[model samples]
Structure formats: C-alpha cells, structure tokens
Target chain A: MDCSFENEIHLEQLMPLIEEYLAQGKPVKFSPRGISMLPMLRQGVDSVILESYKGVPRKYDIPLYRRDDGCFVLHRVVKVGKTYTCIGDNQFNLEHGIRHDQIIAIVTGFYRGTKYYSVNNMGYLLYSRIWHCSRGIRHFCGRCLAGIRRRLR
Target chain B: MKIKDGYIVREVAGTTVVLPTGDDLDLTKMIKLNDTGKFLWQELQQDTDEDRLVAALLREYSVDEATARAGVQRFVNKLKDNGLLI
Candidate 1:
C-alpha cells in the first residue's frame, strides 16, 4: 500500500492525547479528514472542537466513534437508548447499536475559516434540525446530480 | 525566542503536530509538523535563536547551510505568526 500521505495520524493513535484534554474538561480541536460530515464540515478546511461524551448522546449530536475494525467515524446521532443509531449527513443509511464505549467524543463547535460556531449557536441548531428533517429531499437531489454527471460523461 | 508553555510536539502514527494544551488552545488551526518542523519544534521547546536552530538542522540532516537557514527561518516565522513563541 502507498503510504505517501503525510501529516495525518490515525484517530486511535491520537485519542490518548485527545482524552487527556477531555479529562481536563478542555475541548480539543482538530481537522476531520473525510467528507462524511460535509456541508457543515469540509475536510482539511474545517476543524471541530470535541467535548468528551457523557451519559447517552442526544439526537442530532455529532459523535466521533471507533468501530471494532479500528476505523474511526464522525457521524450524527439520530437515536439513543441501549445503543445509539448514527448516520452521516452525506449518508442515507443508519448505523445502529453503537455502544457508549465506542463513542469517544462529541462535537460541540466547529471552525469554518477563522470563525467558530458553537452547537448551541442558533444557526447551527437550525441547520442540524432542518438537515435531519430534509434527508429524503437531499438524497433525491444527490441522485439527480449523479445522474446528470453520468449523462454529461 | 522560546516556545510557549502548554504547546507541545506530539507524534501519532508517524504524524507530528504542535498541539496546544490548557489555555494555550486559543488557535483555530491545527498545526501539522513535517520532519524538519518536528525537529525544530523539539529544539525550540528550550529557548533558542534562529542561528542555533539552523546549526542544529545542519547537524541532523544532510542539508547545506543556506537551506538549513531557510528551513529554520520558515519554521520560526510560522510559529511567530501563530503566536506560539514566547
């Protein structure tokens, strides 16, 4: 496998240090490296401040969790209880039964350019609720866009 | 100039970064360190000047004096801009 990717570390390798900040009750900020949290978060361009997850995650909270296969995911919570159900905004499927232990952090704020927007920010709250509610329309629009691109090719 | 306290060089899965802890985390950008940047960050942890950093780079890597100086200058300027220097 090609390993030319530089300046990027696996989430597992970085978690201990992040946990130290969390344990101190300090928020940790880092750039997420994927498109799974697009629109609100842009890979490399946007960074997020993650707080340590306490108790069960509430609906619409974005969480950073690690899977059994050691892959790390930052997705939005859509359900709660014995286990959580999460789905990325760009994704249509729901990931169910994600235990509390799997969740390491919860995103409280995000930085777009130099500006920081807290989850409690009115715009952010409205965006999350509206986005979650409009998944069907967004998904359909995405399919239409893909089909257009295919036809263009 | 000296590196500020609460800012540390951390390596994870081969990625090196200058991370700020405690009240030092006012910055919005995450600073990723390359190999040379990592070396300089470790050196700057103790108070040192630009020339000393260049000399250290010359000793550590096979780079020549001018290149080392430029590298040191670039790294120091970046830290300075980020308000990471004390």
Candidate 2:
C-alpha cells in the first residue's frame, strides 16, 4: 500500500529503534537522505543495508558513526590508527579523531535501484580506493560541476 | 499463504508501517496498514487463505460475508502486488 508520512522522523529519534533491531541481529535497511556519499550512493535514491560492526573499521570501509554533536555520519574511513579519519566521497574536508566507540555500523552493501552491490565487490573496492586517492581533484571537479548545474538552472 | 520473512512491522509516529529488512532490503516501498489491516497481517503470519481471512473478518467485524470477502480479496491483492506474500 502506498504509504506516505505526513511528518518526517528525525534520524536521532530513529537511531534507537535501528539499534534495537540491529541488536537482535537484524539488518536495517533505509534510504539515506544525504549528498555526502555521492557517486557511489545517491541521495534519496540508493538504499543501504547496515549491520552491526564486529571489529574495528579499516581504511576504505564506510562506517556510520555518531559525532559529538549527536549527528550520525556515513563516511569512508580514510586512515586508521589510534583514531579514525573519515571523509565523505563527495567532500574535501576530512573528519578526524573518531574513536571506535562512536561508530555504530558498517555498510555491508547497498541497492542501486534493484541491483545490489556488496562492499567487498572487486569493482567497488577499486572504485573506493581510486575515489579516496583523488579526493582533492574530485572535490574541485564536483564544485565545477555544481557551478555549471547552477548556471544551467 | 504467509507473510514473507525479512519484513518487520513497526509503529512509527502513530503509523503502523511494514518495512523490508535483511535480504529484502532492496524494497524501498513502505506499506502502511490501518488497525484492521495490522490485525489481518498478524493473522496472516501463520498459514492462512482468503476464506479463513474472510471468516476472521466476519468474526471480528459486523460486516456481511460478501463485504468481508471483497475486503480480504483487496487486501490480499495489494500484498501480492507488493510481493509481500509468499
């Protein structure tokens, strides 16, 4: 049945429910509303499957971590050491000093339309590596593309 | 027929919603059910057919057999269309 919500539910309010399900070993799937993980994940279009992370997040792994401001960010781990540094695929700024406790879950896979792409897929791994390596250039090109789109509008 | 696995029924913001989880995560569409629909869905969790559903509706509501049958048919059709029934 075509169900529409008259009011939007905030992510903070939904996190507890999501956690409860995950605690029961159930994977939570929902359409993430953001433009941060662009190219790989489209806003309001792609849906992701989030499962409770078992171990420490490694570099190139996209983990959903809660920030000190209480906002959950699904970003790629760029560096792993005493602290994890995460940066969105579509952004230039890197988020540093994230601890393991702040991380909620890691993305197992995601659905693009009806097709499912696992995080461990060879092509996805290659793309993530390349994307992570060329963040500066991608950021510049993304800005240029956005400017062009705005001008066109 | 039975309601498939990997679907969770939750009450979100005063709305009863059926969301696909696990392997069915690709299903982006959320199904919202009313009080009656929710009850019927719970019943359908076990093995049930249209006649049994219609009978349950008759037992619960004061509707006639024909009306109950039609309602059950419509509900079953909606679930089938959404690939919710197995």
Candidate 3:
C-alpha cells in the first residue's frame, strides 16, 4: 500500500497524537524531519519507533522532548541530573534543564532504508558510545566534509 | 456511518492527515485528505449519514445540491474502499 503523505505538521500538534498512541501502549512510528540527529538519523529518510519513556533517560539515549518554547527536539542525553542536559548529535551547543515531564518518548529503534536497528542492538550500542565519545573529532570531520561537498558542488 | 476506531485526524502543514493508531500502526498508511475531505470526515465522526453529509457539504461549501451529492458519494466510496468506514 502507498503509505506516505506530504504534510508538514508542527511538533506541538503532532505530539498530542503521538502521545495518544503511546498512551495506548503502542509504539509510534513516523519519519522525523531535521538535521539535528545527523549520521544516526537523516531527514526524510529514516523513520523512528518511539515508546513512552518510564524512567530517567541515561547518557547517550535519544529522547523526544519538548522545550519551553513548544518546540520538540529529538536529541541525545549528554548529562543526567535533576534536569537532563541534551545536545543534538550534530549540534555543538548543549541544551540544559530539560525536565522529566518534558520528555515524551524514547527512540527504541530506527529504520535506515530497509534495515532496522534497535537501541538494544550491540552494534547500535557500540556506535552510540563511540559517537558520544568522539563528538569533538566528529564535529571537525563534519565541517571538513561539508567543505569538500561544497567545493564539489 | 462513523469513521472506524483507531484512526485520528491531524492537521499537518496545511494538509489533513489521517493516521491509524495503536495496533493499526503497522498499517503505515498516512492518508492525506483535502479541505472538502477533511470537512466530510469530521461530519462522519458525529453519527452522520450520507444524506446529512451531503447537506453539510451544501451548507458549508458553495456547491449545488447535485455537486454536493456527487462529492459525498465519491468521498464515501473512497472511505469504503480504504476500509475506513464502519
């Protein structure tokens, strides 16, 4: 079946619908747009499976959270405290003071092309750890790569 | 007729998206409805019949009775074909 739509829904509106589905104890799957969670997730390419989070998010776990500005961000937890500090995988800055109630769901898995990678998968786990550790180096490499791609263009 | 259970309508961008919830997630079908289709779908949700739906379309939109009837028939048929009608 053809299962696609060309609608650009706001995060505020979509969150309620996603929460409703998760409230029913069902995983919600949808393609997220943005370059924030780069490398791991691609805009218009990857689809994520989200389940309602139960406890505090650990370091390196990606959670879908809402900011005070009513914007939803799917970013990795960098620090866990009374309030979690998060940073997008592709971002250089850290977003601090995210509350527990602000977290809507945790990404359990994601589909890249036809292959599905679970958060529990050993390869994904290893990659997550390595990616988190090497952010500085990756950031530099990403800039270099972008320059090269621009030159090619 | 009513829209079947497990289906939720959302407005995305400027388009209407009908998403199936719960176990119906596997359906993976994101149905996009036009303005008229969205109006009709909302009417269907409130214990509406084909006649009432046509009346609503005629009342809300600047369409003639014949056009409204034909539009309602086409819309209902499309919903039936997609197994969205109950």
Provide i-RMS per model in Å. 6.7, 6.4, 7.3
For model 1, report the TM-score of its A chain: 0.87
Instruction: Report the candidate with higher lDDT, 1 versus 3.
Output: 3
Evaluate residue A14 in candidate 1 and report its C-alpha lDDT on the 0 to 100 scale: 70
Q: Which residue pairs show collisions in model 1?
A: none
In candidate 1, how many Å is residue A37 off? 1.1
* Residues forming the 10-long window of minimal summed lDDT in candidate 3 chain A: A1-10
All candidates' TM-scores?
0.76, 0.65, 0.68
User: For model 2, what is the error of residue A87's alpha carbon versus the real structure, in angstroms, after optimal superposition?
Assistant: 1.3
Per DockQ, what order, best first?
Answer: 1, 3, 2
In terms of TM-score, which candidate is stronger, 1 or 3? Answer: 1
* DockQ scores of all models, one per candidate: 0.21, 0.16, 0.17
TM-scores of chain A in all candidate models: 0.87, 0.86, 0.85
lDDT of 3 by residue, B6-85 (tens): 88887655657887764725323567777788888888887789899888887888878887887888888778887888
How would you encode candidate 1's per-residue C-alpha lDDT over A6-35 as one tens digit per residue? 345556767766777788787778788878
User: Model 2 compared with the native: what TM-score?
Assistant: 0.65
Q: Backbone clash tally for model 3?
A: 1
Candidate 3 lDDT by residue in tens digits, A52-137? 89877899898998888888889999999999999987788889999999999998998986689999999999988888889889
Q: Give the lDDT of residue A133 in candidate 2.
A: 88
TM-score of 1: 0.76
